[model samples]
Target: MIYLVEHFYSIQGEGRYIGTPSLFFRFGACNLKCEGFACSEVAPDGTVVVGCDTVYAVNKEHFSSQWGKITKARELLNILELYELPEKSVDIVLTGGEPLLYAQDEIFVEFLQVLHQRGHRICFETNATIAVNFFKYEIYKECIFALSVKLSNSNEPYKKRVRGEVINSIATNAKDAYFKFSVDAESINLGLEDEIFDITSHAPSADVFCMPVGGDKKTVEANTPMLVEFCKAKGYNFSDRLHIRIWDANKGV
Candidate 1:
């Protein structure tokens, strides 16, 4: 039973695959609320802290929004068909509220396999806290995993967030996996350099992307220079949250 938060067709607005046309499937429920990452005071609070980003889908209390009902795999496929991009090859981005929370399920795996068989490139935007034994599946070879590891500045407890062992295991085990970290100026100054070193030590060969934590143009602009400098000093790539810049943290983008 997968509770879909929302689905839409848009350009992939972040990471190495930025600006590519893609279909987005946002699933409901995240293990991490990240209250400290809130973008504005208008943001709602509860199990899910609502901010500029993903305001509509995440509820005020639990971050669980009213997104219709549980959808079967076949029905989801049908829904996807409606927004197919025929001119160019499309990438399917499975995002959250944490999609991996349900990725371990039989139906979800089957759906991924079906998508793979049809020649779709699947990208997973994951929190990196959950250990997905994706290597056990054939489809795993076809999928590109984006491990967006959360840092200490996210206001999440160490135990509740950064699972270095799990991240290391995934980095060592998974094929085509990359590590992306979300950081702010304060975090960069405090210990982000050390954290980045630790992550790269585990996945030395993987390309690392350091993205600024922002939900609006102002925040992105304010933080990008600092992040850019940090990345330059450490020989790392800097990623901008393009969706937030263009859409102002609008949901279903």
Candidate 2:
């Protein structure tokens, strides 16, 4: 059974598809906790506390009670129908604490088939650690994969998070995929260019997006200038965390 986190409609705020109206499905259970990069906190009284920038769906300890259980594929499809808005064609964004952790190829392929039949676009926001053999399935042809590669700044051990082989496989197989990197000024100062070049060496065809690690407007504002300068110097595409800027880290935006 798949452990679903949350599903809602929101604008695609990061990566190449920024500012697009889309339906977001946030699945639970991440392979990586991303400890240092603006994470939830724990209280002295044993309560799990989160930062102001985290979305309710992502702050598992606080919001787990409200998550819906979606067992059958038909039930998930029905849920998609309920979130369909008027006037704009919707794109389905499958995100996660790590959605791929729970989703198997068979279930995802079947779901993709149904969504494709109805003319819906599919986008997978992945951490690029899991080796998804999407080429084996027909649904692979109809999806846009956004491979967000975590860097050293995230505080996740390299062995646990950055698997070069798996990332290479996705870049080699996926029809359309983009490489997005999360960064901060310190990371850039410590030589983000060399790290980015290493990533680009693997996925040469993928478009690179460098997004500032912003959880609030203040952080976003603080990081923007340095990120812009870094991007200009290195010739990388700069991305702003628009949802956090507009909503100030509000959930389900």
Candidate 3:
């Protein structure tokens, strides 16, 4: 079953492919709840809530009520036709609560194949915790992986977020993969430069990208210069959330 939370057309906001106009398919559900005090806020009831920007997709308890479940690739193709994608090659940004969570589902894989056959560039924005076997799932080899591996700042326990085998598999199999990390001052304070080595020790091929971890422009601005300097010093790349910078973190852009 392929559960979709929302789909839209927008410019690629970050990573190596920044600023490219693209079609976005946001899948529903994820295996991790990467909470962090840095991104948390006190609710009206005084509960501190750790929310991801797309919590709608990740919080499965509400997903059935909100997500659109599609059983066939034809239905998806019809929907993409509504968007009237360009005649030339444009990227299909497959995002999620973790789109690869559906990687093993044949129907979902067929959806990907159809998009690929149509000449759309498939870019997956993943947490990179799940590994793909390229021999069995050849379609994955054609997609670019925008790997945003969760870090200590996300408040997920080390064992849950970092998997050496998963990292090795993506490094060894995916057509091309880039390691992007969500950053905050706390992450730098914790010596994240050293932590990157620990996580990518197995698959060191892709360059690392660090984007300020914020949902709004102001928060991102506050952290940008430091992150840029950090990136320069560490020889990692820097990516800004251009959508947030331009549109103030509005959904369905």
lDDT of 1 by residue, 1-253 (tens): 6778788899887777888788998877678766667754342333334442554444434434455455567877886768747765588899877888886777788888888877778998888888777567656657787888777776778777777777776666665778888778878789888877765676678899888888777877888888999999998888888777888756666
Kindly report which residue stretches of model 1 are placed more than 4 angstroms away from their true locations once superposed. 40-52, 55-65
Please, what are the lDDT tens digits per residue for candidate 3 over residues 1-253?
Answer: 7888888888999999999998898999888877672454344445555667676677666445668888887877777778766788789998988998888988888888888887888999999888787889899999899888888888888898898888788877888888988898667878798888888786787788999988778888987988898888888889999989999768788
What's the lDDT for residue 151 in model 3? 86
**Each model's TM-score, in the order given?**
0.88, 0.89, 0.93
lDDT of each: 0.75, 0.75, 0.83
| Per-residue accuracy of model 2 over 29-80 as CA lDDT, tens digit each | 5676665676454443456654323334455656676566666678778776
Locate the minimum summed-lDDT window of 10 residues in model 1.
43-52
Q: Identify the candidate with maximal TM-score.
A: 3
Scored by lDDT, model 3 comes in at 0.83
Residue 155 in candidate 2 has what lDDT?
Answer: 75
* Model 3 CA deviation exceeding 4 Å by range: 37-49
